[model samples]
Target: MTKRNEPLAELVTEAGLSEGGLARRVNELGQDEGLQLTYDYTAVYRWVRKGQRPEPPVPSLIAQALSERLGRQVRPSDFGMTDTASLATRALTYNSDVPGTVDTILELGRTELKSRGMQRRRMMTAPFVLAAAAGPSRDWLLSTLDETFDQDAPRKIGMRQIDGIRGMFKIMQEMDVMRGGGHARVTLVEYLSGYVLPLVRRQHDQEAVQLALYEAAAEQAYLVGWMAYDDGQHGLAQRYLIQSLRLASASKNKVLGAHVLAGMSDQANLLGYPEEALALARVGQRGITISDSPACMADLQILEARALAALARDGRPKGSVTEAVRRAEATFQHVRPDNEPEWARFIDPAYLYGEAAHCFRDIADTAQIDRFASESAAEAARQHRARRGALSQAALVSGDLQRNEIERAATRGQTVISLAETVESSRCIETVRDLTKRFKPHGRMPEVQAFQARAGQLLKVA
Candidate 1:
């Protein structure tokens, strides 16, 4: 048996909290963040008696409760709790010190130098907490630094390594499109950890070379986060994106930083946080002007529109989805493909249509879904982007399902499944999962069951 008289029990007692009261306070705190915790007096007594630590975010919540009562910062360490991370520190915090940021990323990521004490279990499955990322978002907006990357870490590196990162990243981007982020993510992580970290840690004789290295490393980190998101690992993705934001800041690349924020905004939208999504997209937009990079501007605008649409659905009076959509479309029109950056090259008609289809999907506006989804699929096929083709087909299926066109929806659903099979993409599979759920109302029908069964067989998501 473990020893008794835990620091948690002492802290609770010192705070004058009763067994029932601490349980009640923790449960109430959980509610504010959408967690349906069922803590009670018995659970509290067990914790106090055995010095047992609660699971995951509960430790953070318990500390928060005590902090509120004690009118000071009460960290998990204060009570000997080993929470992986809290709302204010570690992965969630945006480190402004350039050298510290690099070291933090080296430790947090899947590098040889990364600490073995890292517990990825919680990060792999943790829920998206708005409070955890809020500070980073605010910090990113207020950030502007004239940074120096002249490190004296003994090792010497040059532009050849930077070129290799950029070259391989291009191939990786294509692989992500062709075979999903999961297809080659482990190899990519190995490359980032094994090949990239050494370049980052070394001394760069020239300022330009150092900046390029940081920027390339930032892009790789962002891609890692994207891969994690595609695999549905939300917490892991959030932390990587936060680190990527810091890297971009150190590189002095505002546009790249904006792109990083765009990824954060995109993930927030996926995880059901419209307010945070909109906030991130808005911050991303502040860095670049429309005339300078219309495609980049359009990407942020559509992301904002998505957040606005989600808010509209949630009955919040933040902004008009329709107006945001108009702005996105207008800005997209100004996109000169040849002049666009390498990253913004995907902002063509088909890409815009697919994103717009999502906006329409969020609002449940089936009126616009058919046109946008059809155009999106057609454009994706024309451009040879199979992943978007699959997602677009799924959107079409969503519309057909909504219209009660079961035959059409089932056929389209089959198309999505077949296309999804072509790529090892969890996002495409997830889209089909939603299609299956939409079939629930028509469960009495054979076609719906067939589609559901087929999805279960293919995606293992029944």
Candidate 2:
């Protein structure tokens, strides 16, 4: 059991806030950030009297609340909850050495396994900040290659364990494609903590074996991050992606590192950091070696175009969006499926077209969006990819809205809602929200109202 938080109690006393008062302030802060926190005095009592730590984002929120009440800066360390706060921030560091990177990544997996409270709490529900992403991204961009991964106490392991991890990665990827990331995240974390860590710590002699393991671990970590992003756990997703990037660097896998950066760019764009998103995408594109991996390069270029398109949507600038799209298209033409990495297998023309639809949507090119969305939908249907199909349908809904075809748009909106109901994906939910929010101006219409009501009920259950 943890010790009592006497320092917190003292601070509470000095701030002259009753337990109830502190709880009220914290709840208010959560609500302002769209979090549904219902803490009362009892929660505060536990923190002060029992030393029970609150879940992440909460510790930071509590510190912020106390800072306001005390008319001074109050940090998590001030309350002896530094580790809890740092758990979220630690991944932002690109360790100067390989062992440090490995330790950090392993610890993250262990923490996720041990902290049931943290797993239950939606710590990443808070708003996204570009500032939080800037440092780690810069560190990754400027990082030198790892020289060695010397362990203090090394044990030799073999290809058997590495193969096991690779097999699991394949299974998890298939499951993610079929059932969505929400369904896969819990299982992925379990595998990370239960299998991968133990194997990594075991003995391994061959440098090739070690490199293979590191790359596999990096891919798995990227999957963890990707699933988190799909579940709308943006902060958690960023942390995992950072660790993945660190692992990719340690393995000297520039292609995989580019992939990791692409994921970061995607997350940043979704979280409203369009500028940082674009920068991340460009970083990924620039980091690639021409002879290293053409598939990786094409993927990064597409992601860069995606970021520029998102920025254009947000009214930043439209000129770059078109050029970015053109460049992505041009690069995509060179992807050789037979030579692509396992991770890049999904970056087909259909995927590119679907993303291009988003770019067209951003630029208000309704006709182009319609064409691309149709192509994406047909391909998604052929492949039985529900998530991508829903995304394509989302673009179509927006296009219908742009054409002032309200009834047709509402119909497509309902289809998206129905498709979303079959998947446990936060990305799907966000798509519904975006479409529903656009429907607000026409809410009085029966179709729009019906779609919104159903979508709301679906989200509530999710």
Error of 1 at 438 (Å): 0.7
lDDT of 2 by residue, 135-217 (tens): 76666666633233333322223567777787788888877776788887877888886777556655678776777777888
TM-score between candidate 2 and the true structure: 0.77
Best candidate, lDDT-wise? 2
Candidate 2's displacement at residue 370, Å, is 1.0
lDDT values of the candidates? 0.77, 0.77
lDDT, candidate 1, 171-224, per-residue tens: 887787777877877777778877886788788888777878888888888888
* Pairs of residues clashing in candidate 1: none
RMSD for each model, in Å, please?
9.6, 9.3
Judge candidate 2 at residue 133 and give its lDDT: 67
